[model samples]
Target: MKKNLLIIPSIIFTFVLLTFFYLLVIERNPSELPSNLLNKDIPIFEAENLIKNKKFISTNEFGNEIILVNFFATWCKPCRDEHSYIKQFNNNGIRVIGINYKDDPKKTIQWLEKLGNPYSDIPIDKHGRIAIDWGVYGIPETFLVNSKGIIKFRHVGPMSKKVFKKINLLIKEIK
Candidate 1:
């Protein structure tokens, strides 16, 4: 009986080890984190505009055209790293709405000035309520929203050239 118990436990351990190795070998994109909001309407939100002296309303901004909704912060290095990619999107005629996540407005303004502002509208997520509502995992999170106001794709972490090309392709397809 003791030998049988030992064999069972060993078999179980071997199975677990094999499963772990299989997962490690499988293809997966770490940046492609699952989001509940995918294929759904963007969360309704209103926030003070960092640049314009007016409120930024979600309903007004999203349904008109395809937009890139980016959650960013001045304090995040990854956000800074992705700024150029964001600018590339803007340069290519993609409308971008940057949600300033838990950051100081003054610092954000200065950062924009230094980096060249790529966002059409800068919405201040002062207390991170907007980010939470969007199911944001971290700074530099980006969502691609269709013209009909549905979220089509989400990417987390700093944008790379590979990701930039992928997003551009997606935009073309979405269009």
Candidate 2:
């Protein structure tokens, strides 16, 4: 009876060791956080347009297509780091709407000009209220919202090549 009990404990320990090894060997980015608003309707708000000189209304903008909304700022290095990937979406005929989070309009305009403007509509979130509504805690956050204005996927940090490919795949699946 004691031998059987010892065998059972040994088996359990071996299983736990294998589980830890499996987890350690898996490919995953630790920095990415899942969005709280997945499959939920986008947060509604009206903000000034940085370029259009008009009220940028959420209801008026969304619900027509599979759009990628980027919450970014000129000051954030990650935002700058991810600019090319963001532009790639535009290059592939995706409409990217940018929410300029708590950034100066002049700096934003200049930055876009230098980086090559990829955004279709640039809305000024002079205060980060829009970001808060979208559950954004960091700059360079990207959200993919479907035609019905439901947020499908969100990436929290700088866009990597791997991440870009993943987003493209997700976009196709949702569409």
* Model 2 agreement with the true structure over 1-175: per-residue lDDT tens digits: 9999999989999999999889789986666678889999999999888888688899998999999999989999999999999999999999999999999899999999899889988888887888998989878899999999999999888999998999999999989
Tens digit of per-residue lDDT, candidate 1, span 100-143: 99999999999999999999999999998999999997788999
Candidate 2 regions with alpha-carbon error over 4 angstroms: none
Pairs with backbone N, CA or C atoms under 3 Å apart (clashes), candidate 2 = none
Number of the predicted model whose TM-score against the real structure is largest: 2
- lDDT at residue 63 of model 1 (Cα atoms): 89
Assess each prediction's global lDDT (C-alpha) against the native.
0.92, 0.91
TM-score of each: 0.86, 0.91
User: Which ranges of candidate 1 are over 4 A from the true structure?
Assistant: 1-22, 29-32
TM-score of 1: 0.86
lDDT of 1: 0.92
For every model in order, what is the number of clashing pairs? 0, 0
